[model samples]
Target chain A: MPQIAISADSYAAQFAAVKRTAPLAGPLASLRDDAFHCFDRLGFPTTRLEEWRFTNIAPIVEVPFQAPAASGGLDREVLDALPLPRSGAPEFVFVNGSFSPDLSDPSGLPPGVRVRSLAASAAGGAGGLDVLTAHLGRLARFQNHAFTALNTAFLRDGAVIEVDGGVVSERPIHLLFASSSAPAPVLSQPRVLIVAGAGSEVRIVESHAGAGDVPYLSNAVTEVSAADHAVVDHYTVVRQADAAYHVGNLAVRLGRASNFSSHTITAGGAIVRNEAGVVLGGEGGECTLNGLYLGNGRQLVDNQTTIDHAMPHCDSHELYKGILDGRSRAVFNGKIIVRLDAQKTDAKQSNKALLLSEDAQITTKPQLEIFADDVKCTHGATIGQLDPDALFYLRSRALSKAQARQLLIHAFAADLLGHIKVEAIRRGLDALLLERLPMSGE
Target chain B: MLEIRDLQAGAGERRILNGIDLVVNPGEVHAVMGPNGSGKSTLAGALAGRDGIEVTGGSATFKGQDLLDLDPEVRAREGLFLAFQYPVEIPGVNNAYLLKAALNEVRKHRGEPELDAMDFMTLARKRMSLLDMDDALLNRPVNDGFSGGEKKRNEIFQLAVLEPSLAILDETDSGLDIDALKTVAAGVNAMRSPERSLIVVTHYQRLLHYIVPDFVHVLYRGRIVKSGGKELALELEEKGYGWLDAEPAAATA
Candidate 1:
């Protein structure tokens, strides 16, 4: 791979400072050491790699970012003013990669359910630390992913969700990661680990937002494991500031007959990239990955997904839609792999983008590799402007040109929005999208 | 209410509507009938201001205003409506939502207050029943997964709801069965008023028997070859378009 000359000395210094401050004494420390060595060797990924061909992280590597320090003089008003849904669910708030107990409300959680900060879990002695070490770095492999390696090396605080067997929590879990501006460009690594036991069901909504227009970087990784017969609904909403950069990764593994679904909604960020990977390791597992991205004003949004059907009778459905305007760019790459023993693996993937402006651009790739003869796989990508006939039809009914375009664009995104079962989140996103639509005057 | 004088239009380089002349006063229903590819749909498309159907020459005036100069929505706001031959399906757009938006826009243009959701639903339900349409169709997406007959009925339903001053029905009878044709024709007849006019464009003479247009003009090769009373439809259906082609000059005169 063609490697860029990233500032290795700066990253090493930052890593040393973080390691010196928050030293873990056992296996977790060793894990961090290993990940640091891997990240040091690999550095930042370049466009030469096959997977990173479309998204270049040169901007991320070039920035001289320091590890985010503990935010002082917390902006309680700003955190409360965020446009998150007040769905009566437990919320865990993190600022600059560290959990804020004053801002979080983790009360009223169900019996046998554990929701706490990873730092608190690590410091609370043996029982919780065992849960953290068991599944923290297992599902999210950092071997080939340079960002994931870097995130693991500096991961100090995030959310840890553990739902005991046979318990289905009625309330959804909300994790809010808010970043504030610093003197220098800040880089925060937030990690999340979710373990849904057998027959347990839970919903989690993770959101990342920046407080100001200051340039910052948010590198986050979330790992989820749904045991047999468990159901998990996971959502990630990224709304960073205009001058910020975000790179997020989601890795999920499903057990036999488990059901897992993820919806990633990206609306803001100057440069944003999301990678989601799902592995159906057991038979009869089902997974659905849905995403919606809106790019405007020279913004860049990229989504990459890989679904692996490792066993027979598993199914996966993926649909990603993007709306680009004002010289913006987007990329969607979906890959589905059906192993040799994965028979009757029904998989479908579709990526559709609406380019509202002449300068807007999108590159979509839907790839499928099936080894089993009995498998059913279909993939399609469509990139087009609004349908002229449909536009005329709406106009013929007295809708103005602007109104008709807005209606059709909203309709194009309604299907993906319908997949969000959380009523509050769905409604919130609907309003946000409508408000962000490019005005006709522009 | 409407006048088209020597109207010439076409798609791309091919001329479709060549020097077409027609006129309709208030309270009149004129049926423009023709065989396939006789530019009947092209006339409707031109009137509706569809893209690519360039108006090469002549003029079309609606209620003393230059119709060609206005946008399609502007024309609709000024009380002109075209019931499409094949209504486009817009998935995920609720039929009721689309109609409400259209109704509000037209109402706003006419200096009337917009209807709230309850008021609009009541009005829409009344019109739906007049057209014998199921209530479930309004909750679904616009024409999406609808049968051909359902789509046609939806056009008429929209007409009832919008209640335009001049309604242009372009081949609305092509995809309907006998019962559906009767229902659609009855719906059209119900909307007839002294202040309103209708242009019922059809390929077959069967629809005229139900609505009974005041004038029937045969559009052949981009021109009206014959114009007569409703009986002309019966004559054309009996003798076929071949007779008109056999004596084009005499028929035009």
Candidate 2:
């Protein structure tokens, strides 16, 4: 077994134990073995790597986190504490990266939509085996990404969603995953696969939440494939524990004339890295990526997004915002790639960060690689503190200095939060953020 | 009532209000006229406790309390309002929300309970109607994408709602047309009472025609160069304030 050069201890034992605890069969077993070997060769990333220069994961790698015992049932503590969508629109719940049938409700799903556990679907049960094999590891760069390789090695059970051709689902599907790392620290790997047929419209809201303030690691991978003329709106909200590490990868592939928009909101974690890569593979396809991240205390929030325009007549738009207070730090790295054949492409990217304290820091990098001659690409990044004139305006209206600061901060967030369409989810997120914001010591 | 004793203030390195003295009693209107950069706005800003104005030596007493010692918000809650020359645009903060918060803070300071949304809306609608302002402006962000006339009218609407004891109009007529100026002046005139005072700072005599002042003071080079009754505004308007520049020794207080 090859050992990761960065870590003194080997993760081969954990892979073997995970296989013994929850084993796959046939092609699934082969896939897991391949992923395990890939992870063993690459290992945990360090700060020396260019992509990980600003993010260091030594604190997370040094910990000994074992895979939890096979999912017994839905964890009551997690179920009670989690603020699952009251929108009751076909919700699926997961505990420790494993799907829980008792908590998931797929009863009211429309006839054209299909929802299944990825593990069961991969095992040649409940049909659609060909689609599973064709797109399971299609987008995830497991060969280079250690965390994704680790997640794929332990890919036991996660949510799989499929939409038939020409079908439009008005109500969104909610996928909620809750990780519990109490008693002992454990690593949870959750994987999601979404496939949409031609001319179909679907929306998905995926939430990742940790239960307690215990030290744990959640490595997640989600792949989305939209067929020709398909429209997809996806949202990912991560509210992890302050003592936890959350690393998530989102890979989206768009077909001819498809429209895909994704909004990612990250609230808290010891260290959180969300990397999203979107490819416009077909002509006339459009992509939009919007993200908002909040950092307080000693937390570190990092967002790395890549948009690839490979075909002519494609457009992409991205806007990301970050709010940092206390001794926290944030990083925003946006890259846009236009292939040589992708002429007449238009892409706009903007990133803005608000620093609420002297110690809060942000590193923003925008990179555009354009090979096409006739393309319009623009990117802008701005970092600033609260507008003193706006604060004085509020204060001159009889508000206290603290009250003025709080109002201005809320106003700054309201512009981005207003983009959320779901009222219930928006309000729930507002409640979650209100308890944390106007962060103490500011 | 407001009293200023040799108020000296500066912006950055340049002194603006150099040893100025003024007294304003209740129910009286004082018009401060000046050419450009003659300390008209600086005097208003210093009285409102705005930043960037270092008060070198001055004592401003508002109703027996030292106004210069208070914070801007404290001065606001104490019923001192400055109608800004250039109203700031605060996107994402609704006008009604700002008004309600400001009104409640002022009311709370005066030992009065805050008005609920419904009650506050009724009061705001009444005040806005008096200014001929649109109700939709209250729902939009404060001064964001608002026209010049609309922004000025909104300021007067806020003045009517807050009902401060002393209202310092700092060039409120700078950007308004004749019709909007009439509406704003009418709104201010409606709030004129025996227990309230007004300090109208203007550059043109046209605004003073609509909202006539009881006293008019011509400011030149930071100090009050000339003080007189209402006729002085007409005299300065006819003379075009160039005489004050031509005659350096004609300074008066």
Candidate 3:
């Protein structure tokens, strides 16, 4: 057995014991232990790991982060600053790992559309935590990632949305994850479980915004299960915070003929890592992942995606584009695995980036592994700058140099943004893209 | 309105135009016919101030100002236009937005009030009709996935919007079919006026049939070998460029 690199701090010791406690006993206890052991052996990754080479998570792991204390009264002024969607009437807000009912509006949700806080669901008697416990440590066990384990050990309040069969909601459900001000650096773990029943459809917009200028870490995990013929449209945006570290894992399980699409837009955070995994467990499922990240300053944003085709006749397409400037760094790691049983699986992935300055850097790797002979899979990555010829052409049309550059950059990022199913979210991301680039208005 | 004196230009290490002198008075159309690599496009690009194409010696003057000294956009604002042989495809930039921005820039330079969106759209639609262009072309990203004929018509549409005094059409008829060729020629002829001088660069003389030039010059080996009236193009066509190679520089001098 590998020796565990256990820290001596009280919080670390309690977390280590919690890993052994089998907090909620069920068929998932063994799975939880294996994940916790793997995390203990690996700890939080440093730059030595190939996947973590560009992004350094030592700043988040080396220092001990206390579990968030009870939320101090959140500032009304700060809430006003959040770039919330205007038309979405019923919204859910989670602050510092606790779901705030006052800040949330859940009146318009359709019947059978269950929206409950993870804490509330765990205490509620319907074996609700069993579902979470079953999937809780599953992703960490498979990937052997440390952050996911940490989130599991320090699990806290988050939203659990369960959509019943064949029901389509007219209004989009919005999830707002906010970090509240703490006396010291706080660690926040927010878990979301979304189970879309058979033939159901739902659109979810999730955003993360950090309050106060103090340092904090948000470790979040979300498991989405799409039943047969179900459809899920998920969009996530991570806005900038001068002093915040955000790590998230999104695991999606697709049943037969299910459809899942997600758009991830990352603009800020000192160090941010977003993992999106799609498991095509049943045949004929379709998955599409589209993302855009704009990083500036010394910020680092890393996107990791995995598409596992376990059954036949599944299709997955991924397009992630980024614009890096101001000495910032970005990494895009996309992997697709087609098992021997998954014949006729069609998968394609593309990662494109634009570097506005010489100092801005991007590392992209698109990997594909296929054991099935009859499957079609392709992946490609490109990192370049604005097209000079296009820029010249636009400038000749009387646009100033800045306008020309903005138009080209906007166009370059638009290909991925166009796929966003939610118009309001797409427009918000477009505005963020314009803000990140050195457009004329700036 | 445009003058080139002993103009020497080259791309990379190879010189394409050497010791060429020409003049285009306002309202005159000059057709420059040449074989491949005769520096016609290089001359147009040099006049428009493109990068990497070095102007080692001599100078070009447009509307009494040094054309070579200005940047491409400033030269454009000063009424210099170069219709690219292969128009660039700029995806995501709407054709109408691009045209309106350019027109307003030129207007601003001329101390004219900017056109509102409605007025601009009205003017653009009018020009589109003149060029026989469809409304869809205005909504699409600039030149993206456009057919060859559509690209040519877009260039003409831009010319109508920019209204440059000096229009250098560099091989604008290269990829056009007979129908597209006629439409392009008609579009160019409609834009021709006493205030605009055109320099049409082409290899074949088919385009000149519709938009007849007042004078024609035969360029060979980085220099203009012959100059004559409109019949000069037909003469060159009747007897290929091989006939011109027979004459020595001393004979022409």
Q: Which candidate leads in TM-score?
A: 1
* Per-candidate TM-score against the hidden true structure: 0.96, 0.95, 0.91
* lDDT head-to-head 1 vs 2, winner: 1
What order do you get sorting by DockQ, best first? 1, 2, 3
Best by lDDT: 1
Candidate 2 regions with alpha-carbon error over 4 angstroms: A1-10, A72-86, A429-442
Model 3 misses residue B121 by how many Å?
Answer: 2.5
Question: Which of 1 and 2 is the better model by DockQ?
Answer: 1
Interface DockQ of candidate 2: 0.76
Query: Model 1 residue A296 lDDT?
Result: 88
lDDT of 3 by residue, B19-66 (tens): 788999999999999989888888878887777789999989888998
Off by over 4 Å in 1: A1-6, A72-74, A80-86, A432-442, B251-253
Candidate 2 structure quality by residue, lDDT tens digits, A360-379: 99999999999999999999
Please compute DockQ, using alpha carbons, for every candidate against the native two-chain complex.
0.84, 0.76, 0.64
**What's the best-to-worst order under TM-score?**
1, 2, 3
> What is the fraction of true interface contacts found in candidate 1?
0.83
Tell me how candidate 1 scores on lDDT. Answer: 0.89
